[model samples]
Target chain A: MSEKNKYQNRRDFVKKVGKWAVALPIAYLGYELIQKTSAQEFVWQIDPYKCTQCGQCETNCVQTVSAVKCMHAYEMCGYCDLCSGYLRQGVKERNTGAELQLCPTSAINRSFIENPYFAYTIDEELCNGCGKCVKGCAAFGNSSLYLQIKHELCVNCNLCSIAQTCPAEAIQRVPNSKAYNLKDGYKPKES
Target chain B: MNKKILYILLFIFIGWNYFIYGQARFPKPEFDSGYNYPEYQITEPISPVWEYIDVAVLLIVLTLTTRFTLKTRSRKSIILISAFSLLYFGFFREGCICSIGSIQNIALTLFNDGYTLPLSVLLFFLIPILFTIGYGRQFCAGACPLGAIQELTGIYPVKLPKTVETILSTVPYIYLVLSILFAATDSHFIICKYDPYVGIFRLNGPSTIMIFGILLLVSGVFINRPYCRFLCPYGVILNWVSRFSGKHLTITPDICTNCRLCETSCPYEAIIPSDLLQEKESMVKSRKKFIIYLILLPIITVGGIFFLQMFSENLAMVNQKVRLAKELRLEKENEIKAISIDAVTFKESGSTLEQLFLEEQQILERFRKGTPWAGGFLGLSLGLALLLTTINRKRDEYKPDQGKCYSCGRCFEYCPIHLEKLELK
Candidate 1:
């Protein structure tokens, strides 16, 4: 081909490539949207119902801090005077005492209830999966407290060491839809 | 005759050891298998066979590129080394897209999410970039498996019509975009998924994809690794990153003399000729085209992606097996609840514990389903598009930039200029 033809061909080729550039991504996104919308469910998701709230998920994760943490079911609280998951020594009569506390990290909180009853709540950042309070409450009180794997801190490792080692075998992978709140008590919206 | 027999026996033994002996069948990565640490974990190690191939290819490319700069050493020893590495890496060890892992990590940083970047990404990106800046894309000449596949193929390299090549080359950029988008969306790395030759090297994966593998191999035999030139999403990324890569193997200023020999020698057409005569005209036109293409491309591409994504949604539904697992999980949970209810009724039910067990299983199932596996398909398709467009060159001759040689050394090995350089010395 002559030089003019070569230059013209190059220019035309560039234009064709340019046309495809416009065409291809639109084609791809079209594929993705079709695939995503048609599917019954999104591929990446967290199941709240199957999580056991075991604290091993805290330290055993690959990231510096485990992504798993405790979430609350604010709706289920009985609001008792003697809160089991929180401090045992009620302030006033429910005043504080170290021995009375159920959590190692002081992550659980106690609030006043009707007459003698007291309300209880958990602080997630401070809560690990040790399940001391869940054990305590399940043994002496209503089984209200539970464990969950918070994804923010979780590395989503392919194989979870904590899941491997959990004595309860409570650590489990979950789909995004059924990912949160497996317990009967108050269910929290978990990420 | 005895010597010939012995040589044949030796070749057979080497080929057998290289191809058959240590074949690895890597399982699909899953959440339940207990192997979650991301760093240093061999997600995809270069197989022993591939290590040899990579080395062999790298040395040959290096020799060719360096021939002009250095002495014209005997070709025999170099050929042997090149052959050895090829056997080691290509046949025995199995090749993988290691560079793509790095690209994924880099893309991951854009999304503020749970995943952290791996160190390997930085290394893979950096090495090629550093090399390209100084030497051009010599990496494509040899070091890259995709490139190596092309170089080793003994086809009469075809200079695609510039129009065709221009159309084909843009595919890599599209591939890069899709790869990044998929990775950003917490999807699988598409480049690694649909790799045509990986199955040949690794000898396992879904068999259907091997059709493409055959296509790549046949095409490699035809002209070069068509995949590497027009389709490699990672190559597209590497080319972009390599542009800013620190000093790389370049055609030395004194040596190039504007001779067009190196241009013809390049199979990938990475060597952009310096347009001294029509530099101003080309630049202004190029700039104008760039603007026009940039503006029109995304609107069309995004529209296309949207439509295709919608179309494929139902076709790509999760397997029945996964659905069954999810169903089974629910049943187990119900069984546990039944046991707990029974326990409350008769004090004989192991229901609470059973319920706990079932719930745990359910959670595990959820994690499994959520993992990103299918994300890379679109990216792979896009990369293929780029490769198809980019490799077409209308120019009758080849040209090399002053910089950006990867020291892969293909030109020196084949370039008449390098041969002349050797004769001068």
Candidate 2:
């Protein structure tokens, strides 16, 4: 190759390297910007305080099956043997029979803590928001049977179909702060 | 045929890879009831195939550039590989945070909430600006997925009429400025929202936006990736950054054998054949025109935007498409009412059903208005201006604009001049 051509080649090489160097920061920053902003998680939760356990949440949703499921507040249970929520009317003792239990699926566990005192714990998998137990519990015992949303299956459509159809107008939209509060007698303070 | 099939298979593999990765790495944003639910949205993960395609394109380009620099015997293979890589990558991955989108996005984000800019977003703005100042439009040549796609697909290269090219190139700049102005004034990045190709890569976003993207893809066959060329906000950034990229894709005097082979290679009509170049005293006049255009471009863009904003209320009222279905429905109701019918027959028609039908039509109309063209004349005029004014040449000048360049390095990789340089190094 001619000397001039060699000199030109050298100049071009340096220029190419310089271009790569210049591109480094841009490529780095571009990669970072794309990675960071693209899909950051947005926190989501449903407020238990506003849910009426009205059962509409389970039926009226757009999804094949409603994503909303009831949750048990096990800690709040008094462990009473003659549980007012579980025992049928005119019954004095807790029994494992279907007629005695308010839950259609017999999902609620009735335990004898002492004579005439009973404790009840709810099984969530079988609890559709029928509200049968909640109504029974609220009327007789402490209103411990309440609704909480299970987010695992919820599609979270923009305008909730279930919330719109709720009869008692109980499913109120709440912010992320108090997502899943238990409906066990704890009243929220006004901001 | 085999090569095309191979290329397609490669493309599918890459796309599938991205799809799988996107599915695994980034799930759809779950329902959030917080302030961040819809606001601080998580961008869905893009196709995993895009990652592979991007790498493949860059590598292929590098290999080709190396071959061109070295004056190697196997240069054609390298170039072919590079072309294939870019095409597969560009087509399957699509483009996002693209220089065009980025420029518009950053400018608007900055102009909007004075204090709310994130550090990452700021970095996006700064890097592209610096690149444009130094390089040229490397982003358009390399990093931009849409550009890469177009470059690959432009197999039967044909130059558009100069008048058309001149008109189209100016549009992006005007769009950039307007996007910035609107963004500053609290408007969303309309450019990004309407970006057609982004939905292809991300798989899902707004449905109308995706339809626009499909239009871009179909149009890409005839007009090249028009978005990257004329309408991408990120292109503005790449153009700026490219100025600062010291080593640009330039058509130097030495590389000129007066042979117009390179002209045939450029689908963008960026390259002027030697006969055309030497024959024209038009160069000086063109330069002068460019200067005048630079000054007037801003004025027209800003003024046009102002005019549009001023009449926005009226424009909204005039978009008859928004109310056509509803008006039609009401008219039908009145017509039905005018017809004196028996109560039993009237009940059979079902007013409730009609109302539901009306509601469904309203929803469909809402979707239509959200289409990219819904911005109507404002978007079209701006896109036209940028495309018409922008001038770029390869061989005689391989100057890729920085703001427009995604730093995909396709120019550096594909430039015959640079490829020769790579061999000696």
lDDT of each: 0.48, 0.49
Task: State the lDDT of candidate 1 residue by residue for B1-425, as single tens digits.
Answer: 99999999999997785343221122112333332221110011112243234434544554464442333333343344344445554455455324544465455444524553333334444455444444445455444655555556646766678788777766766666556654554444566556676666555434656777877677677555677667777666455444443334443324456555565666556577644423333545556655655555545555555544553323222222222334444556765332322122222322454454464454334333322222233444444444433333333334443222333445555555556655787
- What are the models' TM-scores? 0.43, 0.45
- The TM-score obtained by chain A of candidate 2 when compared with the true chain A: 0.61
| Model 2 Cα RMSD, 1 decimal | 18.9
Q: Write the per-residue lDDT of candidate 1 for residues A84-165, one digit (tens) a residue.
A: 5564434445555656676777777675534544546666667765666764554444445556665444433323445533
- Residue A35 CA displacement from its true place in model 2, Å: 21
Where is model 2 chain A poorest over a 10-residue stretch in terms of lDDT? A36-45
Mark the regions of model 2 whose C-alpha exceeds 4 Å error after superposition. A1-191, B1-100, B103-115, B205-207, B251-254, B272-277, B282-309, B312-425
